[model samples]
Target: MVPKAFEAGYPKTLGFRKVVKATIYVKKKEGMSDEDFIDYYNTKHAQRAAPILQRHGIISYSLTYHLERDRKMIQDIMHGKAQLMDYDAICTFVFPDYLALAKFLYDKDGAALSSDHDNFMDDKLMKMMVGDEYLLIEDGNKVG
Candidate 1:
């Protein structure tokens, strides 16, 4: 079942654990300041979400904010090399599998975690991509 140009026993045999990763592209609430958005998401939302996610065996989770000034400088130096994205931040949540992800998202008694989204995130602009992590490199070494 090898794809074109791929060697036999490639990805799965590379010794890396396969995990489901959700990449959430988030936008700040309309008229919300960047500082406030970052602060609330880190100190408020993430704090509240961690316990629920951990209970469901979430492997890892992180948030990365946009660096507009740095990106602009890099783009200027390289003559607009970096494409700009309108997202305020990118959130990554890694789970052991789909079942864990489902539970984390739905098994809760109340929508405490998701309801918190309104505090800082723009619902209309948020997007999520869920898929298996295809690790090609780790610790500067090739794994696949």
Candidate 2:
């Protein structure tokens, strides 16, 4: 179930304690190997964005690369035989709230980070969205 704070169209303010999670779907540029893409994003991009994220009220950031073992699942989905999951990587970020996210976007730091995306991935191929998390399970146990 969706949390009350995240129920309304606008995120409910709870002393800036609620986190706004942004899920980013990324695609590497042409000729870039998967290893290289993951390396640059996890190391170079993340390193450079560390301070910028802190300044923007981001509490955490994580990158999940597509694994070789998951290739079959991806192909099946792409071929319309399975669920949708067409992305090379998933980058998750937790922010203090939506307002902070907005401030980050308008700030020069945000612009710098936006430009940095060109160095490792294709902007035209990236997709991103922000939403709150709902905990329906924990450590193999259901929590509803």
Candidate 3:
């Protein structure tokens, strides 16, 4: 998650815009380890997603491996912060507009990318959380 201060400043500097955040938790089924999932994301899934993202209007995105504390935070958010099995990874994206995002979602390339991701990872037991925030910007510059 972005620091609260940074989140707060986003509206002021970048102006008002919409932010879409997605948190994906890949839970191992008994024998699977967190490292295995990370490797799959870094080595296999990321390679496939990169091209699709570029083809779309994705301005930027990041993939992060959660540390122990971060994992705790995820658990906390999901279940009042109680300790739970660590999450596998976190992915975030910043886009220009909802139409662009929608286009990416419904496009053939996007479906292919999603299919590739499903093929590379074990998402049957995965948990995903998504949220959106709209901030009023000072000027139109931020929208662009």
Candidate 4:
């Protein structure tokens, strides 16, 4: 059965939150191993960006590397033929509101971040999806 919450449909019915979430798909630059890419991003990159994120009203940011071995295993279990996704990593960021997000983009700190991208990842291979968040679940439980 569709939960009573979801049966109503869409954000308002689901108790929409004003926060926006941006999911970014990105690929490493040529010749960087997965280990090197993850290391540089986790250690050097995030350290540099922390202040900019805090200043821009970003609630949080996280980046996760896509595991090819895990993908292969899942495909094997399903008896499915599959190809790897183009992206090497997925990065997510949360913003407090539209104004916060706009400021994050147009502000000087944002410019610094944009300029910094060339140091590690392939900017040409990046894609982003931005949208508001609604909770259909909180922690491990369902939400109504």
- Write one digit per residue (lDDT tens) for candidate 4, span 44-76: 888887787889778889997875666778689
Tens digit of per-residue lDDT, candidate 2, span 24-136? 99887777887888889888888887787788778788888875546776777679465546677888888767766666668886678888888788899899888766656
The residue-by-residue lDDT of candidate 3 on 1-144, one tens digit each, is 444432421444443344545556654335545676667767777776777777766777688766556766777788865655555566766655555556667878677766655544556766766545455544665443
What residue runs in model 3 are displaced by over 4 Å at the alpha carbon? 1-17, 28-30, 67-86, 118-120, 133-144
Q: 5-111, model 1: which lDDT tens digit per residue? A: 32222354455456778899998888888788888999988988888888888899999887566567879988987777888799999877777777788966326
lDDT of 2 at 94: 82
In angstroms, the error of model 2 at 130 is 1.3
lDDT of 4 at 32: 85
CA-lDDT, candidates in order:
0.78, 0.74, 0.60, 0.77
Q: Is candidate 1 or candidate 3 better by TM-score?
A: 1
In model 4, state the lDDT of residue 44. 85
Q: TM-score order of candidates, best first?
A: 1, 4, 2, 3
Error of 4 at 44 (Å): 1.1
Question: Arrange candidates by lDDT, highest first: which order?
Answer: 1, 4, 2, 3
> After superposing candidate 1, which stretches have Cα over 4 Å from the reference?
1-16
In candidate 2, which residue ranges exceed 4 Å CA deviation? 1-17, 67-69, 72-84, 139-144
Predicted structure 2, TM vs. truth: 0.74
Each candidate structure's TM-score, on Cα atoms with residue i matched to residue i, is 0.81, 0.74, 0.56, 0.81
Residue range with the least summed lDDT across 10 consecutive positions in model 4: 1-10
